[model samples]
Target: MSNSNYVLVLFYSRHGSIAEMAKFIARGVNKVTKMDVKIRQVPDVSDTTTIASPAVPDEGAPYCTLEELANCSALAMGSPSYFGSMAAPLKHFIDQTSTLWLTGRLIDKPACGFTSASTMHGGQEQCLHSMMTPLLHHGMVWVGLPYKNKALISTTSGGTPYGASHLANSTNDTTLTEDEKALCEAQGQRIAEMALKLQ
Candidate 1:
């Protein structure tokens, strides 16, 4: 299948909560018949210049390539909060997309963000915004969860108008609350539906 047939679900997770959220979002994308989802991850970044990550990861999703990112029909980006910002690995990967930005390859594509934080007030929304910044610069259409989803109003854990989120607690719990899962799916489904319409 062509890249345009799928929604790219890209994320970075340190303690696994963000990865678990990606799975639920992918489930929502699959709910849209004929639309596919691609789950990819960014490699860990290190301060030492002598060290490098492997070409492929040993577990979970493979590291995303620029080609995969540029060609996707739609995008769902997630990350664990880092001092109210996105994780460095994900930011590092995105920083390399200057080529795509120059080419406007992602222009008009539907996109959304998701995140996980250690606490309810741990800057999940800020992390989501950090993820959306580059996409907006690429001219991608931002897709966000609306108030119409009951989960948004009821979720004490992590649903937001900006995007789906998860409160991982201090233990870094990977498990999502019922509302968080639902909101994740809803965001994915909405992005997929938007992608199809754009096509």
Candidate 2:
């Protein structure tokens, strides 16, 4: 990984909702002066024990490398809700970070998480927390949105202190509510600021 100042916006999106949220979050990260953004995604996991995906994704952001994860100044991770937790693909990608953990490559870096779910009660916060656990174990600082954002108090769709979130509804909607968008942007900006301070 190049020694550059950037926040890694990493995620897995099966239905495009989390992908859209990643872009909005990237926009927020871009707002931080002098900080760049690196957006990456992980390929799907296959149960057949064959090559589940190509070495490179056909489109969208490139797959994340262990070096990129270890070298990033900060991270904004996301996933579509899977049974009140992060999807397996993202978890699998994170599971590979054991090497980083052994070396303390991610120690003290700032990290945060986000999620999107099919229902208002579809465990958005739980998914966010699930994603945070590994980062916490890696010794990264966890950043969270505060209620001062105002949107967190009024969002009927998705917004939380744990992190940014979206209620995609039953059809896997990609559109975010105004509050959700603000929260996503806020999450990006907050992580960027935290990274700068931690640097």
RMSD for each of the candidates: 1.6, 1.9
As for candidate 1, its clashing pairs are none
Candidate 2 has what TM-score? Answer: 0.96
lDDT of 1 at 147: 95
Per residue, candidate 2 scores C-alpha lDDT tens digits across 1-199 of 3338899999999989889999999999989887889999999988753347899999899999999898899999999888899988998888888899999999999999999998888999899899999899999999999999999999899988999999987656899999999999999999999999998
List residue ranges in candidate 2 displaced over 4 A. Answer: 1-3, 48-51
Maximum-lDDT candidate: 2
lDDT of each: 0.91, 0.91
Angstrom error at residue 25, model 1: 0.4
On a 0 to 1 TM-score scale, where does candidate 1 land against the true structure?
A: 0.95
Model 1, which residues run further than 4 Å from truth? 1-4, 48-51
lDDT of 1 by residue, 1-199 (tens): 5345899999988899889999999999999987999999999888753225788888999889999998899999999989999988888888899999999999999999999888889998998899888889999999999999998998899988999999987655888989999999999999999999998
